[model samples]
Target: MSDKPNDLQKIRSVADYQFGKGVGEKLFPGGVKIVHSKRTGRIRHVYLEEKRLATLRPTNGLFSLNIAGAKRIMKHVKPQRLWVRVREEAEPFVARGKSVFAKHVIDADEEIRPQEEVTVTNEKGKVLAVGRAMLSGKEMKAFKRGVAVRVRRGVAEEVKKETLTLV
Candidate 1:
């Protein structure tokens, strides 16, 4: 909203808890804008000038990270939380927005819990998709018959952001 300082701090705290330390400051850097709901006066979205970064869920006080936000966070943070590494063979398919399966997951953050948001990446750590984890990291690596991450956005679609405007 108009008063970005307080809002930024709150969001930063959430990001740091959900992702990892320093990720909050990286995601919502200086000069970024926070959009709030007029009716609720709660943060609804965030942007960096023309690019949409994330959506803030007031109910849960959690952020639903967009592809751009994921990329930004991944770039700056190491040993990132909520990330799953898929094998090379699954790279193209994951980049196309397909769900990641347990068989294809090479590694994952051991702290990842089911139903949490996660970023799917290749072995090289390049982000392929942003999604929700359907299984825990332990299960993803230990099992071979279930979906791991339910992808919400893919790398290919991120390229289309330039053609679209944040609303």
Candidate 2:
């Protein structure tokens, strides 16, 4: 929290494991702030320049990405992992914080597993929302009913941050 090197290393290592290799450094560059839980005094939220980036889940010990964090991944995480590209008809709704249905998914990373963090993108690679995948990537493509991703934050909710992005 106080520009601690250990904190940075821990978060970066977690990011690499959760997203992919080299993602921790990119997602959380220098100067980012780590906020500890008031009740637990444990690292809880991560921020950069006053904007929240991600939250460390206490139950799973995994990072739940904010829109800002998702943008960083889209920009720096090469070859794209854990992405769910949805249909045109669903883009608007997804951008408004709606869950992505299996029938609407155009394509998804086959390696994605259930309960993992995922970014919902448009056809042109625009990040629309960030969420936990309710189904595996293969299931999203194969199934026609049920939810694929339960969106946490949508781009529409953070229109001001839209310009600060990695499309």
**Which model scores highest in TM-score?**
2
RMSD of each: 3.4, 4.5
The residue-by-residue lDDT of candidate 1 on 1-167, one tens digit each, is 57556987988888888887888899999878989999988889999876778898777888888888988888887767788999999898888788998999999999999989898989998889899999999999999988999998888777766547453
- lDDT agreement with native, every candidate: 0.87, 0.93
Residue-level lDDT tens digits of model 2 in 1-167:
56656888889989999999999999999899999999998889999988889999999888999998998899888988999999999998999899999999999999999999999999999999999999999999999999999999999978845566745
Clash number for each model: 0, 0
Badly placed stretches (over 4 Å) of model 1 are 1-5, 161-167
Which residue pairs clash within candidate 1? none
Show the lowest summed lDDT stretch of 10 residues, model 1: 158-167
Model 1: per-residue Cα lDDT at residue 2: 75
To one decimal, what is the Cα RMSD in angstroms of model 2 from the true structure?
A: 4.5
